[model samples]
Target chain A: AQSVAQPEDQVNVAEGNPLTVKCTYSVSGNPYLFWYVQYPNRGLQFLLKYITGDNLVKGSYGFEAEFNKSQTSFHLKKPSALVSDSALYFCAVRDRTNQAGTALIFGKGTTLSVSS
Target chain B: GAGVSQSPSNKVTEKGKDVELRCDPISGHTALYWYRQRLGQGLEFLIYFQGNSAPDKSGLPSDRFSAERTGESVSTLTIQRTQQEDSAVYLCASSLLLAGGRDTQYFGPGTRLTVL
Candidate 1:
């Protein structure tokens, strides 16, 4: 089975400051990692994904994530934060060896609070 | 590009009643998925469908929960004899294809089911 862990329940950062939301994963083989953000009462929106290649992956809304295979982490990052960046962020993983119809394993999610 | 859509954005039902939630995937998407999100929690996979192949129902929590998708289009998830524990937001997502990480899953607004 595959799984994702988001150790922090909530994250706080000041506007214009760099922010990071940590994520870790466990899978049988190579992992397909992804990040998503959710606004109040809305479904999760795709941010980015890490399939292979470069360890650093860029995503929507000026978001980026770094895939550290050795550390089993894929932490989401932003060079500058905005108050509007506050939302719930999720980390997900899919085991590459799993069948075509396998579903993503998600973490509990981290609530981001970017204060002005 | 309409993106994914779901019907009955909110639902309130009494215990022992059966409820059905609907989802319309983005056009041309061949992979669809169902997930449940309880309050203050992350997504929990329910089922997955790729094209017309048999669905992967491993994530289904119980036999009372069932889902069906027709020809890469709309889908309906039916929950029989709803329980208080069944109260949660039912989310639907679709992807163009399911080949490793290239297939990005787009999500819908989700149906908030409140079992009374």
Candidate 2:
């Protein structure tokens, strides 16, 4: 079984300050992790994905995620949070061990509020 | 190039009625997927088509849910005997299938379904 957990229901951060949204996962084998953002009235947009290699993967809108094997965590981070960054964030995972008939499983989602 | 798109941006229907949601994947992309987004829950994988062949429909909630694609271009997801619980936002996504693993799924604005 594969699952993702987003610990926070909402994360409040001050604008121009660093921000982090937590995520953890449970999977049978190595995981293909991804981060996506959803704005109001819009569908999810891919931010970044961690397939292999570097632990830190950079993505669109100055977003990045670090894959920690030991902790089984892939947290989305931004150097300086912008007011526009306020949106819903989701963490998803897929078992890389099996290539066929696998769909990405996502967490409940975290609402990020960047105060100006 | 246009990204994945979905028809019927918003639909309101009475219970027991049938509804159809459409998706237009990006040109040259061979993979298309459908997901459901509940009020608080994150996106749930519903089904996916790999070049007109769906290898996985396990995520679909019930038999009332069925989907089909035409030559990897457009897809239609139909729900019969719609129930109040079926009210949700139907999201469509597409990804390049060259490597499958390396490509990210790009999502559309989605169709907001309201069951009355």
Candidate 3:
């Protein structure tokens, strides 16, 4: 079985400060990790994905995530937080072992609050 | 280009009643997916459709839940005998298939379903 875990329920950060939303996963064989953001009353937006990539993957909205295989973690990071960046973050993983008829398994999500 | 779109932005239904949700994927997208988001929780995979392949029903929670896609365009999810537990935001997403399964899914605004 494939699964994703987001340990933090919420993360608070000041504007212009670096922010990290941690995510870890368990899957059979190699994993394909993804990050998504959702604002209030809106659908989710894809941030980035790690699929047989370099350890570091850059994504939309000045966001990036590092895929750490040894740690089985893919943590989303932003160099500087913006108040507008406050939203719900989700981490998802697709099991490469099952190439067909498989959907992404998502984490419980983490709320990010960036204050001015 | 227009992104994925879902109908009935908000729906309120009574328990034991039947309800149907619709999704329109992006033009030329070969893959479509449906997900459910409960309050303060992560997105749950519901169903997936890719090209002409048999749809993946593995994610559907129960027999009461069923979905169908017409060709590679529109999809409808029907819930028979809806329950309060079925009250959640139903989201639809579409993705262009890429080699090595590196597709990025674009989501719709979602239909907020509330079962009374």
Candidate 4:
């Protein structure tokens, strides 16, 4: 079975500071990892994904994630935090072997709070 | 529509009542998915449909939950005798076919379902 873990329940960072939201996963085969963000009353928005490529992947809204195979982690990062960036972050994974219709297993989510 | 769209943006119903939520996937999208988000939690995959293949209902929580897709465009999720636990935001997403494991999903605003 595929699963994802987000160790932090909440992450607080000052404006302009670097922000990081950690995520780890377990899968039977090569994993397709994804990062999504959700604001209140809205559905999730895709941030980035790591299919197969360089360890570093850039995504929308100036966000990026690093896929560390050895650590089984895909951590979301932003060079500078903004108050508007505060939202709930989720990490998801699906077995690469599964077809496009396979469902993604999501982490418990980490609330990101960026304060000015 | 420019993006995936869900109907009945806000629904409040008494317990044991049945409710139905609808989703309109992006035009030409061959894959659609349904997910549930409880308050303060991440997404939970509910069902997936791809092209003309049978829909995957493995992620559905119970038999009371059912969904149907018309070809590849619109989908409807129905919950019978809904319980308080069923209260959550139901999200819909769509993506292109998965040939290289790089399909990006676009999400809808989601329908907030409240069971009293």
Candidate 5:
């Protein structure tokens, strides 16, 4: 089985400050991790992914995530937050050993609020 | 090129009625996915289609939830005997069927379904 857990339901950050949304996962084998952002009343947008190689992956809108194999974590981070950056963030994963036909499992989601 | 697109951006129906939602994946995308997201939650995987065949439909909530795709292009999800609990944003995503499912999925705008 494969599962992703976003430990925070809501994260508050001031504009220009750093922000982090935590995510952890459990899988039978190595994991393929992904981050997606959803604005109000909009579909999810792909942010970044950790397939192999680099532990740090940069994504859209100045967002990035670090994949730590030892910790089983992939946490989304931003160096400077903006009010427009507020949205719902989701972490998803699929076991690398699983069949390619299988769908990715998603976390419960974290709501990020960047106040001006 | 156009990203994934879903039809009937919004649909409102009475319980017990049948509704069909459509999705058009990006051209040349070989893998398509269907997911459901309720208010304030993350995406729930419903199905995965590679080309025209669905190898995993295990995420379909019930027998009433069914979907089919045509040779890596269009897909339709038909919900029979709709219930209020089925109301949510139905999202479609498409990606290249790369090895180990390492491709980043592009998403559609999503169809918001409301069952009264």
Candidate 6:
């Protein structure tokens, strides 16, 4: 079974500083990875995805992630943080071998706090 | 007309009561999914529906949880005899296609379920 792990439960960064949220995955085959953000009482919003091409994938709200096959990691990053960017972020992975019907497995999530 | 929409933005029900959550996927989307999000937690895949075929109900937690979709448009997730553990936000998402490589899911605002 494919699984994802987010090492940190919360990450705090000042407004204008760079931020990083770590994510790792274990899957049998090539992995399709995704990042999502959820605001208070809102649904999960898609951020970015890495399928089979470039290792670096850019997403909405100035967010981006690097997919490292060797490390089995896909960490979300931003050059600078904004207070509006604070939210609950999730890392998800699905095995490419499962064709089109397999479900995505998500990490426990990491809460990002951007303080001024 | 816009994105995925869920009905009854907030639902408060007593323990042992039955609750129904509705999801209306974006028109022309061929795949629909249901997920649960507890406070401070990531998304848990609850079920997946593709077109009019039988849904992938494997992610359901127990027999008390069930879901139905008509044709390929709207979906309803039904929880029988709800418990405190069932107090979480139920999210619905839709994708234009089912192929795993390039499918991106758009989510609804979610229905917050609180069991008292």
Instruction: Give the winner by TM-score.
Output: 1
List the candidates ranked by DockQ, beginning with the highest: 5, 4, 1, 6, 3, 2
Q: Which candidate, 1 or 5, would have the higher DockQ against the true structure?
A: 5
Q: Which has the better DockQ: candidate 1, or candidate 3?
A: 1
> TM-score of every model?
0.98, 0.97, 0.97, 0.97, 0.97, 0.96
| Model 5 lDDT per residue over A26-45, tens place | 99999999999999888889
Which parts of model 6 are misplaced by more than 4 Å? none
Docking class of 3: medium
Predictions in order: lDDT:
0.93, 0.92, 0.92, 0.92, 0.92, 0.92
* Per-residue accuracy of model 3 over B1-110 as CA lDDT, tens digit each: 99899998999999999999999999999899999999988989999999889888877999999999989999999999999999999999998887666678889999
Consecutive 10-residue window with the lowest summed lDDT within model 5 chain A: A96-105
Q: Which residue pairs in model 6 clash with each other?
A: none
Please provide, for model 3 over A25-107, each residue's C-alpha lDDT reduced to its tens digit, 9 standing for 90 to 100. 99978988899999999998999999885999999999999999999999999999999999999999988766643578899
Superposed model 5: Cα runs more than 4 Å off: none
Worst 10 residues of 3 chain A by lDDT: A95-104
The DockQ value obtained for model 5 is 0.79
Chain A TM per prediction: 0.98, 0.98, 0.97, 0.98, 0.98, 0.98
Q: What lDDT tens digits, residue by residue, belong to model 6 across residues B1-116?
A: 79999999999999999999999999999889999988777789999999877899988999999999998899999999999999999999998875654688889999999999
- The list of candidate 2 runs beyond 4 A from truth reads B98-100
The window of 10 residues in a row where model 2 chain A has the poorest summed lDDT is A94-103
Q: Which ten residues in a row have the lowest lDDT in candidate 4 chain B?
A: B96-105
* Candidate number that wins on DockQ, 3 or 6: 6
- DockQ list for all candidates: 0.73, 0.62, 0.63, 0.73, 0.79, 0.69
lDDT of 5 by residue, B12-52 (tens): 99999999999999999899999999988888989988975
Positional deviation of residue B41's Cα in model 5 after best superposition, in angstroms: 1.6
- DockQ of candidate model 2: 0.62
